[model samples]
Target: MMENKPDEPVDHLSQLPVLRLNLHELAREQRTEQGQLALRDLTRLLSALVAGHAAVQTGQVDWRVRGYTHAQPGGDVQPMIELKVSAVLPLLCQRCLQPALQRVQDKVLFRLVEQEPGLTQEELEAEDEALCVRVAVDIQAMVEDQMLLALPLVPMHEVCPQPIVVAGLEAQPIDLPARASPFAALASLKKGK
Candidate 1:
C-alpha cells in the first residue's frame, strides 16, 4: 500500500484494501491504519440522522478500526473488529424547532463469523453489544451503520435555542356572547303554557 504524503488528504476509507483483510490475520498483524472521510460520503447512511429542520450532510467524522483475535480458555479463537467514531452534527431541536449542535461519539465491536447463527428469540433479545457478520464484510457500510446507531433518537438542546410559545395560548381571547342556561328556555315554555 502506498503511504499518503503528510500534505495530501487521506483517501476515502471505502477505497481502502482493509475491507477484504482476513479478520484473524489482521488481528495478528496489528496493521497501521489511518484515514479521514467526509460525513457527506455516507449520504444514504446519514439520511435518517437529521431532523426535518437541520441539514447534516456537511460535517466531519473521524473513524478508527482495530482487529483482535482472542483465545478463549477453551482455545477457541474469537475474531473481532473494533470501530471508534466521533462527530459533531447539526440537528434541529424538537422543542424549540431550531438548529442545534449534536455531539456523537461511540465505539462498537463486531464479532466475525462464517455465517449468521440462528439464535432463539431469547438469545436474540439478550444479545445487544456484539454483532456477528460474515467474513467478507463491507467495512464502509458497517461504519455508516455504527454511526447511525449512535445518533440520538431525538436531538435537542439542554436549553432551547429559542423559547417555545404555544400559538393558542399566546393568541388573544375572542369576544362572544355568554351562553344562556338550558333552564331559561324551559321557563319560557312553561310561561307560554
Candidate 2:
C-alpha cells in the first residue's frame, strides 16, 4: 500500500501542465513598447523553457515574436504568435563534409489553444480542428522550430566553384586505339591487289 505524505509535496507546477496562452491575452500583456517584449523578462521565460527541454539550444537563437488574439467566426478565441528570426547557424556541408555557417532569415506563424477540461471527444476533436496550443508561447521554441525548418537538408554551393579531389582515389585514364584496325589494312591491300 502506498501512503501519501503531506511533507513530501509533489511539484504541482510540473503537473499543472503546459497551457497555451490566449493570443488576445498575450496581446494585452504586451510590454511597454510595441512589437517587443522586455529582453530581460523574455530571457527569464526563455531560460525556463530551455531548462524544461522545450527548446533546442540557447546560444543559437536570435529573434522576436509578435502575438495577437482574435475571435473566430464560431466565437473560439485564438492566439496567433508570429516570429521573425535571423541567425547564422552551423550546419554540416554535404559536399565537403565540414561544418559550414548558414545564414537563416525566416518567419513562423503558430496558433494558441485554450486550456479547458470537461469537453467531450467530439468537442476536443473540433477544438483540435481549430488551432490548438499544447504549450504556452516560448519565443525560443518558436524561433528554433522556424529556423530549423527553413534550413536546407543538404547545404552546398550552388555552382560548386571549387575543384575537389579525393585523397585516395585518382582519375582513371581513358583507353584509345594504339593502331588502325586490321580491316582497314586489308581493304587497302585488296585495292592494291
Candidate 3:
C-alpha cells in the first residue's frame, strides 16, 4: 500500500468513473474501454468478501470491455460486447471454515438485444453460461454481477492448511433387499393360471 502524507494531494487517475454505456452507440462505433477500480467502490462485491482477509486486503479490480457489431445472414446487425474482469476475492472455505483466497476471472460475450416477448434478459444470463443484455449498461454493476457468478460454488483450497474435525455421525453403508424383477410378477401369474 502506498502511503501519502497528510499534506500531499491525492491522484485520482487510478480511480474509475461510474459509466453507464449506451450499448447501441458502443456497437455502432466499435468502442473499447479498460481501467482499474477500487474494490471499496464496488459496494456489492465488497460486501460479499470475507472481512479482514489478506487476499482481498489490497481491494482492487481490473476490467476491460469492447463493443462491436456482427452482420447476420439476413443483413441484421447484432450488437455485442466482450467483457473481461479479474479479481482476488476472500471467501470462507466450506471445507475448513477458514478464509480462502479465490481468484475469480470472467470473460463474457454478451449479445445485446431489445426487449424480447416474454423472457427477461437477466434470466437469459444462465443459459449455457452465455450472457445477454438490453438497454443501457451500468459497467460497475455489470462487473459485480459477472464477478459474483464466476465465484466458486464451494470455495476451498486444494490442500487445507490443517484438517478440521466436526462432530457428526459417521456414515455407514446400507444394505437393502433387492426387489424382484418385473418379469417375476408375470411368471408368478402364469404359474397360478
> For residues 45-140, could you state the per-residue lDDT of candidate 2 as single tens digits?
333222333122433456665666657899965656666776555455678755455676776555554655456887656423234555445444
lDDT of each: 0.68, 0.53, 0.77
- Highest-scoring model, lDDT: 3
Residue-level lDDT tens digits of model 1 in 1-193: 9888999986565474544445555556655343555676676645655544233545777778787776779998877667788778776678887777888888866666666667778646642345555355565666677788888888889998567888768467778899999999999999998
Residue 44 deviation, candidate 3, in Å?
Answer: 1.4
> Which lDDT tens digits does candidate 3 get at residues 8-32?
9775534656688886788789999
Write down the worst ten-residue block by lDDT for model 1: 126-135
Model 2 C-alpha RMSD vs. true structure (Å) is: 12.6
Query: Which candidate, 1 or 2, would have the higher TM-score against the true structure?
Result: 1
* Model 2 spans with C-alpha error above 4 angstroms: 1-24, 28-60, 74-77, 115-131, 134-136, 159-162, 167-169, 172-193
Ranking of all candidate structures by their TM-score, best first: 3, 1, 2
RMSD of 1: 8.6
Error of 2 at 66 (Å): 1.0
